[model samples]
Target chain A: MKGPRLTEIVAGLPAIVPFVGPETQERQRGRPFRARLGANENVFGPSPAAVEAMARAARDAWMYGDPECHDLRAAIASQHGVAPENVLVGEGIDGILGLAVRLVVAPGDPVVTSLGGYPTLNYHVAGHGGRLVQVPYRDDHEDPEALVAAAWEHGARLVYLANPDNPMGTWHDAATIGRMIAELPEDVLFLLDEAYVEFAPAGAVPAIDISDPRVLRLRTFSKAHGMAGARIGYALGAADVIAAFDRIRNHFGVSRIAQAGALAALGDRASLDRVVKEVAAARDAIARIARQNGLTPVPSATNFVAIDCGGDGDFARRVLAELIARDIFVRMPSVAPLDRCIRISCGRAEDLELLARALPDALAAARA
Target chain B: MKGPRLTEIVAGLPAIVPFVGPETQERQRGRPFRARLGANENVFGPSPAAVEAMARAARDAWMYGDPECHDLRAAIASQHGVAPENVLVGEGIDGILGLAVRLVVAPGDPVVTSLGGYPTLNYHVAGHGGRLVQVPYRDDHEDPEALVAAAWEHGARLVYLANPDNPMGTWHDAATIGRMIAELPEDVLFLLDEAYVEFAPAGAVPAIDISDPRVLRLRTFSKAHGMAGARIGYALGAADVIAAFDRIRNHFGVSRIAQAGALAALGDRASLDRVVKEVAAARDAIARIARQNGLTPVPSATNFVAIDCGGDGDFARRVLAELIARDIFVRMPSVAPLDRCIRISCGRAEDLELLARALPDALAAARA
Candidate 1:
């Protein structure tokens, strides 16, 4: 009755999920959320055109998707003014992160990232037996200097950074990032995650030449384009680095309906622009609400606002739990200093109103 | 500006795709196929109810799919009379194959499968640095005896077998397979892919005994339920084996629309029964047409028929090319002996008509 033993590394690993989805919590509570502002999902929704394209595609779901992802890749290449060979579309950035880790990391190879950064990437590195070297955040921002120094110290093959960072919603301007990129060791490949780039300020994202083989930039439709449920994302890199994906990727992993939906979503720039504007207004409203409640709202370059609890991590955790109990779903950071804040996403008017009403009572309960 | 070097194993790997989808071939020829019988897809199409479900879910594509795949897993578990912990929904059997390889295989690890078996599984094993030990088909069927011998000889950590097999459309009955399973080495895991099981004979599948944790059964909506483009599949195994998937799988990889479509497809047994009946008729039609063209069609347990070319691999390849040139899309096995046969999938009357008209000319050209 015994199963075959897993590989030594896999046996040592804990079966941990990076995030406990709200769905799981709802199932535990035996009820659905009245307001869902967690996970940074676009409650503003996808474009009407994209929805129509998906509906049209639904009837023809018998045939397998094009393994090459031809049309979608061509559209992405055109938008970026690059050759199609420079782009590799995957299930999502999360999927691509796994592939990237597989390509470069052998057992015990070193990888570097900010301590409180994207856990999914670190999960992939660990899955592949990579040794992770952590660098602590500085003043609520990813300390690029510390990350570069750690990479060099550990002889790390990979380093990950999110522009317009998550959890804290802070950012470093393009010039600052460019200077940090120059300091990265020649052998250390930079994985620049720009999941929130479309919502960042004009000068926040750098215009680095993608022909630099030392860097791979990841982008997703989940945030700005509002196709999170579609699971479409892409990586842009030098042609050689991008071509390596063909050596091991699940070529037919992206569904046909997803490709159709993402292509249509990309074409609807007006909808994207409108979402960006709405997100900005929502951020301002959230900040005002936080100030009225005597909480400090961190300066945000992304869709979500991180409200400083003006207390310790335990207080922030209690506030998050109280919000969940009130049927208002929100999240908080997982690590030390950053964990002292609660993150709220941009939601529809009704969802925001619910959050607004629930927060004061939730805060009071946490305080009590 | 060179990036970090890929591992020695990955650097030596060729850039090869396990299966070239029909869509890619159509793009290369700059014309669509008159009949898509190459990939064994269910040309009968998915249920209308499933299509409607997907269409309805399309508007809500802005929210990320529940990473837990809660509802679909619950439904599948209920259908199978098992707990939800025993089921893990994935992108497809292809995606699950990759995860299995990651969990069990390490560099230089031995893995066993039939020669010319599911190439995607082989691709994943090689991608993860496993040394593949292949056993040849016996009398046009996978020899479970040889597979077991090879596994023992090489101390293989895993072995893969497809029932109602692809390429050759052959199968071994439950008694024979159960005997093989009983004889298998205790530490060696068996991946029994039942992708086309619904189309198989009633007695072909063995009774489920999940107590034997060394066996993991994979099933898919891609074949019998006619949802290949939806990209939804599931794996059933012991709780420990199933739990391992959570440590590495892309949590939000399956799209919301796809999950909805697959769940609806699973619930519609009447549609599935009708499709099975239609598939049997189509298989018979394909065999009849092959006989009319002076070819010998292999007896099949699944949705496709393989016709022996009465010559070597070269003649079969020429015949396949001629079929493609005539806009009748078909495929053949990649290795020798089996390569002397061409595979054609079950399809509707109109699609079979295209095949019927094209086969004679292709055969004559091959003879010439």
Candidate 2:
């Protein structure tokens, strides 16, 4: 029997999820993880106010959400000091990345990103049939200069960079990013993913310039605001670029509960600050744990830490596997050199305690 | 500055929202509608258990939902007596529609749909650069035969049919749809949108046959389950067709709360039956109200009724405006013939009473 014909791009693409969720892992293992410190989810949870708002909004789930995301966009604009027209709210950073790719990267187009950077971003690029030009990381950090150079070399349509980078948890200062932006080709759209920017230190976040159409800044409530399950994120860009999303985006894709929860979460600055503080403390504790276990921890600006396992990629793999077997979930970077480190998200003290308890045994097993 | 370059398809299309949400209207009017009978939302609300499940899930919103939607898909599969591979849950029907369009529609591909059918479906077609061949409705129902003819005429890649049709609140029986499916070309995909099928008359829905590779049946919790704001929907089809969705779908786009709510909603058969009954009563009340206002009510097997205002599209539009002015939210079809009718969703008795009180004045104002 003949099947539905997929687009040439999609037909050629392999079916794979960028990251398997911990739930899937739990289901496979037939047991839940002791410490869910893998996905970089804010284990601190959303603000009590946001939780209350979402719970309350649950009763009103009969009504579809505002398609334009007006109020939430307005609030986000007010917070970011940009016009509402410059902001586009979507399902999540993942969803926004897909839209951004669709907007610019047609089939056979060239796109640039760090090697072993965000897999989901690459997934969107490949899903759109974009030929990806990968720039190897410099000292485990996304090398901005090399990215721009590759974009120019490849005549890339888009360049993706995650500030306070994922997996490595390293960051470039605002001035450094500004310099990179200045050096980029005018025609190449820069997708600046700042999903973990909430945990970045002061001066790490670049100033928002809505006039520059070349840059799209992505922010999500999933990290610092702790609403990952809500699947709400926003992109800040030039008015026209933001407006172009309406041509293709699912208008009501952002749910009422998500909007309400994100709005409430954004308003709760005290909760955000508290979570940041908690994340910082947890990061330090994770670093201390690494040191105590004879591993070196990478300095991090984000909520997660990458610990050098003092071994090769295969050893790191074994460590990861042993951790998973111990019911302690953690992920490591993909590819050589970088894959020698395991990434751990900030967790509550009890969660960290479980991780700390598992590390020695896991490391010993890897050594075996 | 050079802006982000859009895909040729997106660049050519105007940035227009398919539907102007009621919230947008509320913002413009600076007042909330007393009766919201537009959008075909179920005013009976979600099952209490579903609401409770969502409310409870809200607290755990820090972690992303399972990317594979494992448990929910299993539940849906068992409920439909299909394999989990046959079900693909997404953000909503809107989201699933977008993915479906992306899956099969390459630039310049031909697509067939009823004129004045779901605008969002047309929007997706346009977004994907699909050439839409619209078949005019026969009587008030979407002409299955005409659609198939048009598909053959245009060499269409996909044909869209909304069973228990929107706006006009019309439908065809199972046999007619089965015949339509049988007539479709082997190369053409059939996108059967059953968003309103839960409220469709008994025997109106065709039996699920996952063996049919060309047909995809879309279902949603947004209608009879009263979880529109949750933005959760699923598509059932041949395992391969369903699997193709993962090639481009935002894996974690379905929220945790949405999964919990939908799972719980599906389990509460008593609540669903109650909602279907209440909606039938509401439909009758709406028809009575239309008759009281000297208008004709179209026969409906869905949650909404289409009231023919004894006028043309222009007059119907004016009546719609007057209803808006009277704090009643109702919608009308976009094209001729169907445009002569104003569609009202099933609402509670009080909301219908408001509609009853407002209709006469709205009609008179339009006449003036």
- For this target, which candidate reaches the highest lDDT against the unseen true structure? 2
Instruction: Give the alpha carbon lDDT tens digit for every residue of A165-208 in model 1.
Output: 98889999999889888888887678999999999998998885
Lowest lDDT 10-residue stretch of candidate 1 chain B:
B15-24
DockQ-derived CAPRI band for the predicted complex in model 2: high
Looking at model 2, the pairs that clash are none
lDDT, candidate 2, at A230 = 90
Q: What local lDDT does model 1 show for residue B192?
A: 95
Per-prediction DockQ scores? 0.79, 0.83
> Candidates' lDDT values, in order?
0.90, 0.92
Docking class of 1: medium
Please state every model's RMSD to the true fold in angstroms.
1.1, 1.1
Can you write out model 1's per-residue Cα lDDT over B1-368, one digit (the tens) per residue? 76768877789799655568888888889999988999889989999889999988888888888888999999999998888889999999999999999889988899999998888998999998899998999999999999998988999899999998888999999998898899888987899999999999978898777778888999998999998988999998888889888888888788898899988998999999999999999999999999998899999999999999899999999999999999988988888889999999999999999999999998999788
